[model samples]
Target: MDSFDAIVVGSGFGGSVTAYRLAEAGLRVCLLERGKAYPPGSFPRSPHETAKNFWDPSSQLFGMYDLWSFSKLDALVSSGLGGGSLIYANVLIRKPETWFVNESIDGGYERWPVTREDLDPHYDSVERMLDAQPYPFDQKPYEDTPKTVAMQEAAGKLGLSWELPKLAITFARPNEAPAPGVEIPGGDDNLHHSPRSTCRLVGECDLGCNFGSKNSLDLTYLSAAQRRGADIRTFCEVRAFEPVDGGFQVSYIEHRPGQDGDPAAPPLRGAVRARRLILSAGALGTPYLLLRNRSAFPALSPALGSRFSGNGDFLGMIVKARRLQEEGGDGELVPRLLAPSYGPVVTSAMFMPDAHDEGGTGRGFYIEDAGYPEFLNWLVENNVLTMSHRVGRFLLRRAWSAATHSPKSQVGRSAADALSKGLFTATSLPMLGMGRDVPDGRVFLREGHLDLDWDLTASKPYFDRLNKTMGEVSKSLGGRYWASPLWLLNRLITVHPLGGAPMGRDRREGVVDSYGQVYGYPGLSIADGSVMPGPVGPNPSLTIAALADRSAERIIDDHRRNPAGRP
Candidate 1:
């Protein structure tokens, strides 16, 4: 079996960052990613393609989206060489300085062994690597993005702080003016070996950026790691690992594309040895792997599956928002063109600072304008009776004019009006909420499968506060508000699941130490959201990468001190 100095599992923010750092540090590194790599323009969008766009190993459907359902929550994550970065909205906000609550909440307390100050330099390093930049809303064409404007107006009315958060996207080449929907530079040199284009304002970031504008891991860390001589394998799913005499032995299944279609095809098994192992398979995956491979490490922390949280993610919508132009006007209510599907998945963010500040109650959360694809606009237009009415009226008028007037009577003007009139889709916005909620949820193995024991009863107040704030924002924008569909059933959905293996001062509190090393297992570390002791009060991707950067430094120092890889 091939052996290496370090092996990192799952190429998300954590795994990719670790791979790049270790490779740069001159370590013999290997990265294992279960999903296939998605080069530019490979993400599927058509109905037939999307129909099969799910992660199901039984049917051999290996797609990007991986959905999981628990008793209290539904989770959506990505499955690809780039991991969640391929499907994330590209927000790269740092964890708030004061929002790191180390005290107890309703259900359970949150404590972080590493503070914001400890991660400042690491955050800078990650930001530079990802090429983070704020959405250039001040530019001409982007200045009037309706959803962004509407969000800012609502925040101003509500007396909240609103600003454009940094995003991992390439809007223009170096020293060039910002332009959308144009050919991007540096495509030939990218790892994917595919041409890419600038962001076209398609709101398809969550669907995977086919244009390669988003600086996802595949374009950044993974590519850098490969260039630095890291061995990367895709479609190789790690089943389990155990510490051997001097190193760890990993067993995995090597999946072949055509082989999956044949029932009689035997499974291809593979194994490798590594002096050091890093688990970056994300919060749920890492914990599940450890729980299933529990016998391998009997001295693993008791907090293996403890401190689970959804990062207080809540989804809501603001529909039929009135334009600021409608204010103080005597004419009919002019619906604002929020046009939620016109820009990136997220463009601007409004922060609700935590109660640590005076005159605040529970923990604070962030609300951003969420977006979808323009195809969804057709569905939105079809759902509204007024829109159909306008189209129907225009068609009837066109038919009458053709019959009464010239045979070549013009319908172009009326058709344009019909297509544009009463379009409610242009006036809707999706509200994405995330912040600190109680981290009381627990993960455990049930009948040899991973299961979650979580309830919203204890965190009801926090969610209620979030919903009430969203309701107020909707009212301020003259729109109707609605929570997620699952909310009525007391269930929540989260894309940013955090904390299954958390960091602490010692084994009693966390599965890993401040440096993300397993307490009893030297040379074994976790550099993912699973190691978050508490919820990061923003998009957790940046923080996860920063933590991984820090963890990689520790691993490098340890390796340097003991060249033989002894702990």
Candidate 2:
């Protein structure tokens, strides 16, 4: 059996950062992932190819961003070596300072044990590694689609703070060809050999960066950690952990592909030994893993599954002009408009903290632009239009067939085709609102599977506030408020789920301590979204990385002080 100084599970922001830091400190680290390593060219970009993209149902159950079909809520997430980063819009954002934790708020829980001050340095470190930078260009040509630029203009009028978003995309330089694979220190052998390429701005990042410009964990930290001598094994799903004499017995399964590379194969089980265990399986996966290992830690805090919250996220579509000529535009392609599908999913954000003051009906939510891949157009045409009584079922069926069968060649032929075309020409923008959600959700183990019992009724105030702000921005941009009625009918969707297994002074109030160490276990630790004690009020990726870095440093310091295990 192979053993290491540390074993990090999941290769997302948290796991990757922890692995890199530990490996840099001369600790032998094994990073285990339940999915295959997605190379630059391996991603499917075309609409037809994207439909076939599916995550393992079993593994998806444990992922933060897994596509979930529950009796309660509709959720979507990804599973792979890079985890959700493989499919997420690379928006690197910092949580607002006020979002740390405030007990003054009604129904608020205890304050976050580790404040902004304790995480500043780690945030700085993560930003540098990911090459976080602001949008390069100031002016966009799309006038009909007023996304970030329009939001900023509206926020300025409202006397609110709006800023260009920090992105993780690498654009091409003049006279430079796309670099697909380039070597970087501490990168994986494949990624190190893979060249770095420029982004084509094909607006297909959400599907996967086939162009290789988006710096996801697989291309950044995970790759770097591999180069630093950390052993990363993919398609290895961890089942549970058992406490051993001086370490832990880690059990996992090897996944195989079915015919034509479909996800239809029996899993082969195996086990390994590790001295130190780091759980970075994300909020959903980590909790699931712990539930599976419940027998090992029966005395864990009852708070292990409490205080769960999603960074209240909402999506709305805004279209300024129905056609290029509708909004006083020249030529077939609209100019002076910022299309939501042009660049990173989120390139700018507007903060509205005061929107919730004075017993306001709303809460803090930032309105940014959301970019969708071409595949979503099909979904919009089939699902969104079919709901309209005007479109007959006979016509809708034909449209669905045409949209799905001939996606690439027959691109501009469906109901959504015209809108998508206009969008491509910068006539539309998808507005996104993210805020702190009420932490009324509960995480628990049922039949050894992680379960989430979340309700949005308590989040009515926050959503109301978000809608008001969004409406204001829409009117200012001379655009109409557009969104999937599904959101209104079934609440909203969230990509950043946080606050489970939070940190506190004792197990009575939290699962882990300020440093992310399990209260009863000496070497066991958590360095992921599971430890985020409260709503981050922003994209949780960067914050999760920062927290992991800080936790790893503390763990290393403690390990150095007491080489032998001590509680």
Among these predictions, the greatest lDDT belongs to: 1
Provide the global lDDT of candidate 1 against the true structure: 0.88
Number of the top-ranking candidate, with TM-score as the measure = 1
lDDT (Cα, tens digit) per residue for candidate 1, span 182-288: 88767546678878777889999998888889999999999999999999999888999999968898899877755434542344899988989999999999999
Residue 500 alpha-carbon offset, candidate 2, angstroms? 2.2
lDDT of 2 at 21: 94
Measured against the true structure, the TM-scores of the candidates, in listed sequence, are 0.94, 0.83
Worst 10-residue lDDT window, candidate 1: 258-267
- Model 2 misplaced regions, further than 4 Å: 46-48, 57-65, 104-106, 139-146, 172-192, 259-265, 321-338, 354-362, 374-426, 564-567
Candidate 1 deviant stretches above 4 angstroms: 104-106, 259-266, 324-331, 383-408, 412-422, 565-567
**TM-score of candidate 1 to 2 decimals:** 0.94
